[model samples]
Target: MHIHKKLVSLITLSLVLLNTTACSQRIGALNDTLKLAFIGDKDVKLSTQQVNDIPYASIYAQIGDMSQVFIVLVFAEPKVSLTQVPTTLSTELKWLSADKGMIVTVNGRLVRTHNNPTGDLVAVESTEPDPIMLGLQLASTPKTWTRIIDWQPGYHFGYRATSYFNLVGQEKILINDIPTQALHYSETVLVDDLNIQYQNEFWLTPETGNVIKSRQKIAPNLPFIDISLLKPFAS
Candidate 1:
């Protein structure tokens, strides 16, 4: 009877260990499944009411100038606000509040910005470089060449690297049925170890030095992203 009782206790312990291991494996598999689901979802869709309610402009980013994939650029909701106003501006016209400041979002996700010192757009988030600033810099600066540190976001990790920009010239282009004066420029990024050179183009409004259209390459593995300003936000 003593030996039988000892055998029964041993079997019970073995079953407990097996059940614990199985539960751990199941939890790990669940975690992996969640990660994959998050990674696979790339599109972020906002309702028309949401877009109209916010003080934001809409721009479309096309991949490679060929692929059907398109990404929308706008400010992320709730986290960003346009509450502050410029004191010296005309009292008759109400503008979007800039008190809370603004942020640039790509596909509803925050990317880096290239702040143009002369332009109206400003970077509130410090983690990413501002592309709008870069566009304004290219438009306003008299110098023919300049360099910038650009940040590219990724799935798990992002990278920042030096990129060079050159002012190509100025031209009048008809965008959205309007004849607009724009400053043309080109950007070149060199990936040293990869020996890959990526080229991008930009057209900024000459008056405000804001980016009107652009062909930007954020990563060597990704296609060139073309952005066109659909319309400016109406206050």
Candidate 2:
């Protein structure tokens, strides 16, 4: 299931909704692709209405130039979904695409990926707790950490990377027309061995610190994947 190489800058998409009427209309228009999503269409889209109408929790996922709505199908250890969202802090989420591609995340961080377009992320590991698991604590100040990552297609393994995080302050955010103030944080990751550097961002709820939205890169060259919780499970 290789997606089109054409990229839709996730940064630009971050500004897609601004808690306004126009934003709602735009969202509805974007999700008009739902009719085609089931057929494995590329660049698929989803609406908050679609999420609400569904019985299961859902997520809006985008990789490369394709986007789709995935739902929770299995809720257990390492919660699984046929493409989806995360429910709580320090939780592992496994999302499966229409064609059976899998993306797994821990604490809202990309941990592994399989059957991706360009390649796959074999795994990401760290001896210490990932800063994200700390949730709201990470927002108090800037911090840094390190981790080792492995990838497939080229047998790349054991590449270490350092990540620096800085709080970008609280801001008004709207999801599914519900308004809330969320903490924004910026993350920069550098892998000196591969001469690779990438940026990731997260928006966490002020209270529970659950990541409601994020833009993350799985490997050095793989395009960033965007995941946004459209419907969350009860805590």
Candidate 3:
């Protein structure tokens, strides 16, 4: 009974080609099964002296498909020593509207309550969970990948350079231990130079027709620290 309840709590869904990671079946033998990938988190060190590498956390998710959402969380922990004062580790939630207008009731509150000019973020339900899991439900959905059209480059869409806004075929990444191809497109949300961008790597799963992995920089604009796929929250 306890095990069954645990299973009930788990959010079940398929992943699109994906976030910190994606879950998909292989081509032939494993094409019909749903493979789940859970990544863990790493420590982050923030510094004001670095060029663009700002303080950030690694990312991990539990991607899902269909009528799902991309839940993401952030964290930063220091591993050097017990004395290495760690940065305030947490997830800065950036919930988006299903449409392009506004996220009506995010976590229950009106979009205007949490949306601000610079950063008027409001806590929905703050708890230390897996950032990747938060995103998995949405990541599993092929829609998640398609939402970013620039990434559809025949094979796979991802980051292949230092700055995705202008370059490609340079930055490389590993997915499930294999080399994959990627595209680049850095968007400036705020100002031109003061924009946000990332270095990304994507892996597509033909089995599920969704993305499998997405390794991105913490910040696409300012080179902050990076977050890789690790694990997900107890859905």
Candidate 4:
């Protein structure tokens, strides 16, 4: 039976999170301090109380365009040439707590309720996670680097912190009241048995020091996961 793309994608994305977030601080950058995160620009004012008094649960954060997009894409696009989505101040995404499990909803509609082992706890609006379909069944898979590029601090950049499907990720960052850069990161993991690789790019606003947007793509030609931040209001 042919599986629906949505289900496949979400499952894959789910698996990706499991492998990517489990690394400890000593293992690599996947730590509480330097987590593989995409917090928004530090310059913007954020609404941190949409759910509990503490910054918990998923959020519909609004991404302001006043900031700038990361520059890693400019350096790596020539090699991967994946999609580069725009950076909107406010977009569609379930912002979860930096730690612990989170429940997501929009306009009072349930979205997702899962805990990211890496500390990020939110899910997209029915988009398939990007690993199950790509054959990232285990985190101890072999991998290769298609290209190496430099990313100016603040924008996004992709690097292999592990051997799993190389992670192609990004982040939008704003430092100290200015749209400093976009923190983009991506890693392409290679599982020999599957013969497929993953290329993902995330867009986040450093102004808020949180991931405002994220996108992912599979090899040979497949649709990518596009996520953006939505404005959070009193619930």
Candidate 5:
């Protein structure tokens, strides 16, 4: 009778051990899947500084009818960082001048422009309107008719004016076989008694609002800039 009792006890112990091992394996599998999901859904922010000899952001542009592509490196800082918010991304573009830049809100609203010709970055003051902000607004709000403040940077200041955006239409296009949507718009700026015209186009991913390609005319003298977001480097 003692031998039979010992046998029953051994079987119960073995079953408990087996069940514990299976539960541990299942928990480990659950943890592994959760880790993968977190990695895939995390947002990424990058700068112009190279990582393993690869730049974080690279933009390629080709002027009108030009076969050669011009490259622009995008950097990140308080100056030029695009911060991801719950709804949209807030962008700030600082010109070569440390004191001059434009800030756009998450909803693509041009909040302000600052200048510190005194060479003090900390002493920047919101002084005038910005034309670059107008271009950005056009890129962000393609479906809405928006009025933009137009200006061109000059030696000491920027030429300021008002402009209106008119949407041409939307067309289906393919970038690297990824079907995309594009919006074409024309802008008319009124300065003094003269009117300046610009044509803007933006190719974007409909789901993410990521701009794949863009063509913008900042000034008549400056080259009409065409920008294509470089794959593998664009975050």
Candidate 6:
């Protein structure tokens, strides 16, 4: 579809693509799909009952001021869902829109992205396990790690970066208007080569160590993306 038409479709429907066991079949009609009506309204809130009625796993994603609910569309060009990556500690979650815009995350961290208007984060590599995958603990001290990141549209690649993770204590947060307690952690990433530095935050379930919400900036030029799990793909 043309870029302009795709944008119109997205704005009109406000729904992400769909996913099922079979990756080849087209989903139901767009009008029948559940709509994500609140795009850029920060004051918008959803009830737990409203989220529970949705049959598919979903997430609330905000890039800059616009927010939308994206589903796990396995039929996406790259094709993936909540699954373990073989020989790796990271599990991948691929969020794609009707327009084929994709955001690939591992252990709730933005690792790769495609079809982003501000240029995509092509890849992220790390020699050591990410602190997020290790699970942040209350008694844990500050930790640091490094990564090699790549970007596209300008063929920017192999930029070295460092990140520091520090526990900020337990806090109460609301998801879908339901109050819950979570462990909060702060991360600071510094990319000397690109002369860039940014802060990322994560709120995880204290018992399971699963990330419930996060705000991350994968690259210097990219907008800080905020994600909140509305319907968990995991059992």
Evaluated with TM-score, which candidate comes out highest? 6
Query: Compared with the true structure, what per-residue lDDT tens digits does model 1 show for residues 58-126?
Result: 444444543222122222332322322222111111111111112244322223333212122212223
Of 2 and 5, the candidate ranking higher by TM-score: 2
RMSD of candidates 1 onward, in order: 18.5, 10.2, 20.3, 19.2, 20.5, 5.2
Cα lDDT of model 4 by residue, 89-134, tens digit: 1222233333222433332222233442222212221122223212
Candidate 4 yields a Cα-based lDDT of: 0.30
| Candidate 2 lDDT, 152-188, residue by residue in tens | 7887999988999888888887776678778898899
Residue 140, candidate 3: alpha-carbon lDDT: 33
- Candidate 4 has what TM-score? 0.26
Q: lDDT (CA) for every model shown? A: 0.42, 0.64, 0.24, 0.30, 0.36, 0.68
Clashing pairs in 5: none
Model 5's TM-score against the true structure: 0.42
Highest lDDT scorer: 6
* lDDT at residue 231 of model 3 (Cα atoms): 22
Q: What is the lDDT of residue 18 in candidate 4?
A: 48
Q: Each prediction's TM-score against the native?
A: 0.45, 0.73, 0.23, 0.26, 0.42, 0.77
200: Cα error in model 6, Å: 0.6
Tell me the spans in candidate 2 whose CA falls farther than 4 Å from its real position.
Answer: 1-36, 40-42, 68-75, 78-90, 136-142
Q: What C-alpha lDDT does candidate 3 achieve relative to the native structure?
A: 0.24
lDDT at residue 60 of model 6 (Cα atoms): 72
Candidate 6 minimal-lDDT segment of 10 residues: 75-84
What tens-digit string does per-residue lDDT give for candidate 5 at 122-198? 21122322323334334554332323233334332333445565656776765434466765444554433335555
